[model samples]
Target: MGLFSKDIKTMDDLFVHTLKDIYYAENQILKALPDMIEKATDGGLKQGLQAHLGETKNHVVRLEQVFKMHGAKAEGVACPAIDGIIEETNEIAGEIDDKKGLDAALIAAGQAVEHYEMTRYGTLIAWARQLGRADCANILEQNLKEEKAADAKLTALAERGINAKAA
Candidate 1:
């Protein structure tokens, strides 16, 4: 069912729907990260993307676990927000010819993905708590922490040199 579908008549339904949305998004990121890794010119950026790719795979597994805990099928629904973010990343990356500029754009793109995930996981954790599923909330908190760390890493990388190199 769509986000506005009348079938989601309760908080549980909304929670599950959002869960499916992130599940879909995480899977999509799994598919997209390799290309981003390939496009990255900076060694640090490449290694960082590779590390997050592994974390993202675990994120998918953790999401599946949450689905099982919630008594829902481990499945996904289309997530246009992540799709758009990835598309924008690809478009911007394509436009940049300089290695440093491309690396900078890639870091920005990675941070954008992390920010999106942080928002989703944060909301999911809050909703899980409100739904009285502290178990699920606690599990989701791990993913949220990882997302925040990933963003911070990207910021540090940029501050250290990627941004200046781009200039």
Candidate 2:
């Protein structure tokens, strides 16, 4: 069913729909990271992206687990927000030629993605709790922690040199 479909008549339905949204988004990120990795010019940025790529893969697995726990199918619905973020990143990356600038842009893009994930996870955790699924909330919290850490790491890398070098 489409987003805002009348089929979603309850919080549980909303929760599951959001879960599917993130599941699709995570899988898209899995597909997009390699290109971002390729475009990155900084060693630290590349390494960070690679590491997060691995973490993202595990996140997909964790999401599937949550789906099973919630008695929902381990499937995904298209997430236009993530798609737009990734597309914007690609467009910006294509427009830039300077290596340092590209790296900085990449870091910014990565942080954008992390911020999106943090919001999603934060909501999911709250909904899970409200739905009396502490188990699901706890599991989603792990993903939220990872997303926050990745954002912080990107910020640290940018502050250390990437941003200045870009400037």
Q: Encode model 1's per-residue lDDT on 1-167: one tens digit a residue.
A: 67979989899999999999999999999999999999998899899999999999999999999999999999999998999999999999899989899999999999999999999999999999999999999989999999999999999999999999899
With candidate 2 superimposed using the best TM-score fit, by how many Å does residue 71's alpha carbon deviate from the native?
0.5
Question: lDDT tens digits, residues 1-167, model 2?
Answer: 78899989999999999999999999999999999999988899999999999999999999999999999998999898999999999999999989899999999999999999999999999999999999999999999999999999999999999999999
Candidate 2: regions farther than 4 A off:
none
**Model 2 residue 8 lDDT?**
96
Q: Which residue window of length 10 is worst by lDDT in model 2?
A: 1-10
Off by over 4 Å in 1: none
Question: What is candidate 2's CA lDDT for residue 163?
Answer: 97
Query: Cα deviation in Å at residue 67, candidate 2?
Result: 0.4
Quote model 2's TM-score: 0.98
